[model samples]
Every structure is written in C-alpha cells, then in structure tokens.
Target: MASDSEVIARGDWYPAHSSRSAAAALVPRTGELIAIGADGVALSVSVVSALSFSSRVGAIPRRIIFADGSVFETADNDAIDHYLRSSGHKSVSCAYRLEKLHPRILVFALLVILLGVGIYRYALPALVELAVLVTPPIVPELISSGALSTLDKTALAPTRLSEHRQKIIVERFERVASGAEGESYKLNFRVGGLIGPNAFALPDGNIVITDELVALAGGDDEMLAAVLAHEVGHVEGKHSLRQIYRAAGVAGLVMLIAGDVGSGVEDVLTQGGGLLALSYSRAAESEADRRSVDLMRNAGMDPVALVRFFDALEEKLADHSRTSMLSTHPGTPDRKDAILKYRAGSD
Candidate 1:
C-alpha cells in the first residue's frame, strides 16, 4: 500500500498468465512493484533486486522483467535511472551512462572518429595491396574482360584512326613496351568521344589510348611514348586492380552492415568500368610518372618530352574540362617539378 509519492515509475504490466495488461508502478526505497487494476493493488511484489532492466537509449521505451516471466514497459527512463542510482539495485551498463553528455564521453567519441580516419587513410591501402598479391591470376583476367566490355558499352567507341596511322603508332609503342620488364603489354586505340584526351590500363596488361590523346600529342613520338609508358607502369604495378579491390572491399563492408545489399560486388566489377580511369591515387600517379621517365630514358627517348607535354597541355587545356584526365591527375605544376627533379637525379 505505497502512496503515489513512493511510485518511482509507471508502466503497463503484462502477466505471464494472460496477454492482458494493467497499469503498474515501480515503488522505490522499499523494493516493491504494484499492479493497479480497476479495484487497485491487484498484485504486489517485493523483488526489485531480482528484476532485470533493459539498457536505456534515447527516448526508446525501457523494459523491466520480473521473476514470474512478466514484463513491465515504460517510457520514463529518467525515473528508472534515478531509482537505480538512489537504491543501487545494480550497476547500469556503461553504454547507458555514456548517453549523458559528459566531457569524457565526448573525448572518447572524438578518439573513435580519429581511429576510423587513421584506418581508412593508412591501413586500407596497405591491406588492399596485400589482397592484390594473394588474388589469383584468373581474377584480374576476369575483371579486365568484364571491364573492357563495360567500357565499350558505356564510354568507348571504336577507333576511327586509319590502319596506316595505327600501324605507325603501334610500331613506335613497341619500342616503349620493350623496356617494361616481366609482363608484356599490348596497345589498343579508341575514339574516346566524351572521354577526351586520356590513356589508362586494364588489369590484363592492356593499355588503352584514345584518338584524342594522339591528336593532343600532335604526332610527337616521344610524347606518345611517354603516355603509353605511363600506362604500362600502372599495369606493371597492378595499380588499377589494387584501386578496384580497395573500392570493392569498402562496398563489401557496407553491404555486410546494411542487410539489404544484393549483387553490388558484381555490379562494381562488371558495370563500373567508367570509374576505373579516374580512380587512381596521387601517389600511384606519381609512381607511374617516375616509371614513365625511366622507361623513356631506357628506350632512347627523351624523358623531357613528358615534362614538355605537361607544359603544352596546361597551355592547350586552359579550361580544364569537367570530364578530362586533367581533372583527376595530380596538380600539373607540382608533378612537372617532380619529373624535372627526378630526371635530373637519374641523369
């Protein structure tokens, strides 16, 4: 027979005997709970220590369970907290306590965010590189085959360049390819259309160059060789495949968490070819640039042609069109400086 003042929380009680429920109250200080039917005090229990409480989370209803397999649910989370703190029924979980805006909790939250950033920035690429090493040879061939078909269906058009022009470029490019060690590469030409002046590689040692890029090179064999050699470097290092794996790993993680995911991994590989050209990291781009310079020097071509091509490109592409390789590559001036310094050191 506790007074209203003694009731710390009010809720609906559902007895194990029936699905029906009635108004209930949690009376603190004396460790008692009461169910009030129309007749009042239909049941009373003195088992607060034996009761289990659901963890408190913002505004979500909390539950209390009794020894008789009955449940009491209430929205008055603060009253339950006060009862626990005052009576010391049992320690509430740290997660529930952290919901309060404490300085220490905010600091912990900040540290967690920083750790996530650190893992994405540093750990992800290292992990992706390791994955690339263990991946089977057939995997790259499969990804490359799918990606080429996807590109043909989406961004690329058949090459309109004549057999004579293609023959000459192919002959000249062979000299450049000869310097690339271990894996050999075959050069392919495309019309590019909206892709503008660009060159990129597939995972299977296939280097694709566009007619627009040939036109941009203005038939300077050294400049064309530089671009082709740069793409060869990407293939040699498996840079494109590494990036695709990195992105796919992230997509796979999101799918595992989101529960509604379906066929996204297949889509990323077979339908996402358009993204492959622009997904290169700046560090990867720089490494390819160095390899380009090294190969050009080895092939009896001037590495300075690459530096001059950058200068000429900056002059020609004053607008930096929204959908061009210039938009994704590292800053031209800094890259040019690095190339000059590198060439000087190599010489």
Candidate 2:
C-alpha cells in the first residue's frame, strides 16, 4: 500500500544473524524482493532470478523462497497474489496451475485414465509379443517344469489309464506330433479330477491331456489323435509362451489398478484371468485348430475328428456352459463351422 509500484507482505522470517524467527515484511522493488526486520533492519535482498513462490494451497501460508535457502513465510496470501499479478510473475509450478484451475484437473485425470486403458489393451499386448520373440528357450523350460509340478500337487493327479491304453495313445499322438515342433515335444497324461476333460500345451513342448479327456474320447484313436495334434499345434506355434506373457501383462495391469479390490472381486479377476490365459483367445484357438488340421492331414488322419470331438464335448459338458457358444474358444458351433469351412477350402 506504500505505492502502486511496491507491495509488502507482513510475515515472520528467520534472519541469518537471529537465533530465532522475528517479525518481518517482504517489500517488492523494481525487480527484486527485500526483507526488513521489525526495527527496520535490512535482512535479505532476493533478485528476480533467485526468487521463487510456493504453491497456493487452500488457506495455508505461502513461502517466498530465495536462492540462499532462506524463506519468507507469510499468511497474507491476497497481498502476495496481488504482488505477483502486478509484477507479472507467473507461477510455473504444476501444483499452482492445477489449484488455480481445479476443474481441469478432472479432465486431466480422465485423459490419464484413457491413456492407461490404451496402454493396457493395445500397447501391452504388442509389447508382450515382442518380448516373447526375444525370450530365451531356457525360460520356457523352467516355467513349464514349475507349472507341471504345481498342477500335479493341486488339480491334476497321476493318470489312471492302463499301461496298455497309455502306450497306444502315446504312440498315436507321437505320430500326430511327428511333423511338428520336432522331437523335443512329448505327451503326458493326468487325471483331470475336477478340471474336466481338457488338454493343454506347456511352453516347453510338453502336452498334458486329462484322463477325463481320454475317457471322453470313448476309445476313438482318431478323435484322441486329433486332440493331441491340436495340443502339439499349440507347441509348434509357441502359443503357450505367448499366453504366459499375456497373462503376466494382465496380472501387472490388474495389480496396478487393484488398490482396494477386496478378496472376492480380486478372486473373480484372478479366476477369469486364469481362464483367459488357458483359453489363449479365439484367434489363438483358431490358429491351433488350423495347425491341428494340417498336422492331422500330414499324419494321414481324419481332420473331422476334431469337429466330432467338439460335438461330443458340447453334449457331455452341456451343464457346465464351458463349450457354450458364448464362452471362450469361439464356442463349439463357431469352431465346428470354421473347421468345416477350413477343410472345404471356403474359410
């Protein structure tokens, strides 16, 4: 109020010579700030280059900071704001801008949310695909070993199929796997228990077919052979490895978002994510089915056996809704039609 060219903020400041804080006033000059003690003792002079302002947060006091680490604390926010406006001193801090335009913060938050979704849905998968391309062979072997051991202890048990049955099935599947993924691939049998009739390919070219699936085949070697070839197709295309990386990406994304999801929702997400990984997407399933067809044709086996297998599964597991037209794996109907079209050269 002394003059239009000057504004002063009455505050408390700690002078270098003082043992404690004392009454002080910040006086703005042509292009600098000067601090004076209550008795009119000159305390500090801060040039524009060495001067900074703290963010205006609510009704909290603001600080006029200087290069020498000294700060002028003041509760006179209006005076300081007037001084900054009159002196053409624009605060460049994000906190200040955001507070000044608080409504825009919501818009900014929405943009950030959209960007995160884009990264998770689109960019993450592309990144995982690239990562899978560079993954070392040993990594898959270690992962497969650990996964098999864990399953053996939990959902899967030792196969109950007779040695004769096991031998015949293994030999037949060996023929189906002959022209794909080389000799490193092997087949194993397990009692699916509650997992139902299913087959899965490990990253390291090992395929495990549940005993329930073998029983589901009803002793038809062509159907069993087709199923094994489909799993080998998974091995040949490195689909399992892709699934492993995708699942990891999903887990990371979910963890990034799940700050407070309770056990129930988190459990639902976990189970859904597991099913997603195991299903390997409709595209991947289709690719494996095609691969299955190719491998079966190469081995002089019937390709229609896969379609028949689907029909049988749809009938047997009708109560489970697993093979429904809405579930993962393109639904049994879509897959059957696709397979038929592929075989007939109309796909």
Candidate 3:
C-alpha cells in the first residue's frame, strides 16, 4: 500500500457500480492516486485495481478508471501522467511534450519553419517554372478567353479605332511577335474604361491594348509595337499565372504558420492578393521591358522608341492626376536608363 501523503493526483471519485447509484451519490469524495508495486495502482479509497486513463475530445479533465467499479478524475493531468510514468505503469494521454517546453519539439518546429521558408523562396519558384514549361499551348487561349470575357463585361469597351488603323497596328504587332511560339498570339483593342493608357497580357496569349494607349503613342507604330512585344514577353514567361500562384502560396504559408485563429486570415490573404499581384507584375514588367528592347532591336525598330513612349505616358498621367501604367509595371526612369545603356552596348 502506498502512503496517503504520497499523493500523485487529487480529484473526486464515485464508488457506485451502476449509473443510477453513481448519480445518487451526487457528492464526490476527494481521492488520490499513488504508486503501489511496479505496475499496480490504488485509489485513496483502499480499492487497488488495474488503472487506465481515458479522455474524450475537447474534454478538459482526464478520467481514471478502476477495475473495482470506481472512478477518479483530476484537472492536473500533467501530475497524473508524471506519477503513472514514474510508477512504471503505461500512460496513454493526449498530451504534447512540447507543452512542457521539450527541447526536441521546439527544434523540430524550428526545422519545419525553416524548411517552409526555403520551399517558399526557392522550390516554389522552380516548381512554377517547371509547371509553366509543361503547360499546354491551348491553356493560355482558354485563360485569355475567360479573362477577356470577364473584362468585357466589367471594364472594357469596344475599340473605337478605325478598322483600317486597327489592321495596320495588328500587322505591326504580328511582325514584332513573329518569333514567339507556342502561344497563339491574338491582339485585342479595347477602350480603357477605368484603366487608362494600359496594355496588359492575360495568362493566355491575348494582349489587350487600350485605345487610350494607342492614342497616347500618337500613332507611333514603333511605340505600339514595343508595347505589344512587352505583353508578348509576359505570355512567353507565364508571368500572370506565376503571379497568381505565388500569391496563393504565400497566403497559404502564412495561414499555416498562423494556425487556425479565425476567418480573418482568409480575409487578409484575399484582400492582400491584389497588392501581391501588383508587386509581381512589376518584376514581370522589368522582364518584359528587357524582352521588348531585344524584340525592337531585332525587328529593326529603335529601342529608344520604348523609352520615349514611357516618358510620354508618365507625363500624361501626371498631367491628368491619374496613375500611370507605372503603378503596376513601375520603374520608368530606371527602365529608360537601362534601355539606353543596352542601346549603347549594342552599338
């Protein structure tokens, strides 16, 4: 028999064998669990029997069952667990050692966090690249179709440019786009609606150029072709799809790290998505600018035309108190400087 003073757990007990009798004994007598022989367990009531711990999901206190139709429970589950383990009895409790500040658990969690960061920074981008490489030619077409349809319903108006002028621009754009393959390049002309003087690429090969943008270029076919070539760079690089995926991945990773707090995480991720997209679009624009300069040089058009066009666009936006394409694509002066440098190098 273990000493009563050697209390491993302190809680209420029910000595009744039947549920009715147990209910009748509404008052619970204080009880303690103490170690006996190597594998034996005894309650404070002097009833020694095989003991086991069981718990229900979301239940706070743990229950200790005795073979002699008695029960014990305590809120101090850690004390109970420690007593059982120390007494050489098997303990089955859903308790994480991490809760007790176990070093190994903390290290494991740290490793998981580091691994997640590495995958997010490096592996994810590589995976996106691989995915884009294997994507079918028709996928972009379908994406463009759906996206253009949506824009048409909400943000775009039919092109007001004369058919003859539209045809001339289309021919020029085609010549600029000639070397690009696997994407069925289709030119779209739309009135800018809320987005003035913009040209953007869908995940598919459709490039939408605003009529405002065309008029902004002041009928400089070379400037228009440069913009078309830039959009082509986006399609070739799968920038739009990659941007969307990266934002979603980041949102998921943040939520995973945060655990289940509430729906606020979802709302934050959703609202921040557009901001992330804009940032990624800036990088995409830089890449497209590089490609545009190359295409302009190859097509025998002066690459300086693109730099001049960006300057004009920037001035126009400033005069109107409107956000330029620079709001998304960004880097007007730096991009212009880089283009001039590239032109100088190519000379």
TM-score of each: 0.66, 0.64, 0.61
Residue 276 of model 2, lDDT score: 28
Model 3 CA deviation exceeding 4 Å by range: 1-113, 258-283, 319-324
- Top-TM-score candidate index: 1
Please give, for residues 1-347, the per-residue lDDT of candidate 2 as tens digits.
23324447888776544548777888866777887777777677889778878867767898887767677889988888777777777763456555777677789878878877898789998988898789888877877777777678777889998999999998888888877864388889999776768777777888888888888888888998887787787777787677667766666666676554335333322332342235667787888888878888888889767988888787787787653212435555688888888978932
lDDT by residue (1-347, candidate 1, tens digit) is 44678677788888876678777776654556545443456454546767888988878888888777777778998888887787765656677666777898799878866766676678877889899889888887787778877788778899999999999888767888898876668988987877778887888888788998899888786888888888888888888788787777767655544555577666767663534544677888888899999988888988867887787688777676444677556566688889889999989
Candidates sorted by lDDT, descending order? 1, 2, 3
Compare candidates 2 and 3 on TM-score and give the better one. 2
lDDT of 1 at 213: 87
Off by over 4 Å in 2: 1-102, 254-277, 323-330
